[model samples]
Target: MAKTTLSLLPLILCLLYISGTAASANFIKASCSATAYPAVCVQSLSVFATTIQKSPRQLAQTALSVSLARAQSTKSFVTKLTKFKGLKAREYEAIKDCLEEMGDTVDRLSKSVLELKRVGKARGPDFLWHLSNVDTWVSAAITDGNTCMDGFAGRAMDGRIKTSIRARVTNVAQVTSNALALINQFAAKY
Candidate 1:
């Protein structure tokens, strides 16, 4: 009987693991459904399912981290674009402003991530206050991305440069938007 029980242990553990995984996926899907870019949210976050494990706070933190990474990558791409020669003076100026905005976006997202880490320990009003700070910083980050894209507007900017920068910034903005939505959901439930 002991031998039989020991043999069954692996099977029981496997079943538990499978159930946990499905629950995580289902939780992510449900949380993402409330986001502005639900598909992007799910695709970007599904890999962290095991870690998130149906917790709203974990989901929000992971979303913020993903958004921060995207912002940093987009900022680097814009920085590289600035080195191109023969750009119109207007185009160069636009690139300069965009780089600054992206820098600000990265800063705001970083702060939001840090604040989110603190939300776990706070109680009562403190939790709400920390969550509010995260919400404000994330919203500011989204604004910065939009501001970067705005610099590329009109026919004065190089078509390719404008298109590429706008595309990348738009993607970051959407990711940030999803993060903000997740944060709001977390706040509501908490």
Candidate 2:
């Protein structure tokens, strides 16, 4: 009986050791996966910011091509808030805030792109400078939109509000695509 009890003790210890090792491995894997979310968030933000920065330029170009009366200033285009009928005043206010926040983000990103170019010129590596500029612009656009969308509980609002938000998102997508194209053009030239 004493010998059997001793043998069982060793088996119990071995099982405990194995279980701990597995738990630690699983923990490490989960920690690594959790850390990756911020990086993904940053990348997403950058893409959105880049899109916002490019939208005005594309809109301006289209306006010019069609000979439509152009806004005397780019900032004018930035604040073109949409008015949706059937939305509550509170909903309208929320939408306005979202748009304003997004617009501010776009403006900041545009400035960052210019600043990157200036910094690149001052520094030695031209390629790195251009890449940095593109990265900054993209990051700014995405971050701004995400920030606004984070606050946008308009998903629960009326269909009009939802539709308006969708339209804005589509517009952002178009701008992002154009910015990517512009980046490709720059790359080709380089």
Candidate 3:
């Protein structure tokens, strides 16, 4: 009986782990449903389910982290595109302006992530202030993304460059928008 019990232990543990992971994933899926871009939110964040679990704070932080990562990568890609020739003067200028906006976006998102880490430790009015700061920074980050695209908004903007930049910027913005939605849900529950 002891031998049989020992042999079953590992199998039981494995099953438990699988079930826990599934539960976490389910939590993420349901939480993402509240976002503006549920599909993007789930796709980008589902991989971090184990870390996020069912905690609203964790979910919000993870979403902000994901958005920051996407913003950083998109900024890098746009920077690389600047090295190529054939872009119109205005297009080049727009890219430069966008790089600045992306920088601001990254900085704001970083601040929000750090601020959220403190929200759990804060109480009453302090908690509200920290959460409000996170919300404000995230909203500003969204605006930074939109402002980047605005630099290229005229008829003379090169189509190919415009198309590529717009797509990437729009994606990051959408992802950030989802993060904001998650943050709002977190706030509401508080």
Candidate 4:
């Protein structure tokens, strides 16, 4: 019995030590998880910034496509303005002026994007702000796009045109929302 108890004592102590170690490890893991948001945000932003950096040519190509589309739409609008038979001349002029203002605003935004791209190239992965509020980041993106659309809407001379612009703006807003959600999911996981 004495020999059996001596052997059992070491086994018991070993088991107790293992359990203590495991419990401490688990506690650390839980604590890390609880405080992981900022780190996750930083990591995800880094990945996103890197992705953006990796495809500068592609981004520029996409921007070109956007510019082309906007130009085509503006041409169509100008053609329509020239042929509008029912509207008074002054009304048509007002619409044309509004469209011109909106075009200038879009041009400014495109220029800003170009500038941002240049800054991003020079700064590497430091272009994106280290933001903790995922929602706010998303909201800002949407607001920026919407502000452009709003400039168009404010200049819009007719309900039909306003509605069309609003639909397009909503689509852009949805895309921005999706991007934010994706970023947030990545932040949560890593």
Q: How does each model score on lDDT?
A: 0.92, 0.46, 0.90, 0.44
For candidate 1, write residues 104-149 as lDDT tens digits.
9999999999999999999999998998899888999989988887
RMSD of 1: 1.6
What are the per-residue Cα lDDT tens digits for candidate 3 across 1-190?
Answer: 9999999999999998889889989988998898888999999988998898788888998999999999999889889978878877777889999999999999999999999999989999999999999989999999998999999987888588889889988889988999999988888898
Q: Give the TM-score of candidate 1.
A: 0.93
By how many angstroms RMSD does model 4 differ from the true structure?
15.6
Q: What clash count goes with each model?
A: 0, 10, 0, 0
Off by over 4 Å in 1: 1-8
| CA displacement after TM-score superposition, residue 138 of candidate 3 (Å) | 0.5
Q: Which stretches of candidate 4 lie over 4 Å from their true place?
A: 1-75, 124-190
What's each prediction's TM-score? 0.93, 0.43, 0.95, 0.36
Q: By lDDT, highest first, what's the ranking? A: 1, 3, 2, 4
Q: Write the per-residue lDDT of candidate 4 for residues 1-190, one digit (tens) a residue.
A: 9999998999999998667655544432332243224333222233233223324333222322343344345535544654667865555665565455445434543444454335335432443332233245345545655554544434434566556655554544443343344434433432
Cα misplacement distance, residue 69 of candidate 1 (Å): 0.5
The predicted structure with the larger TM-score, 3 or 4, is 3
Candidate No. with top TM-score: 3
Local distance difference test, candidate 2: 0.46
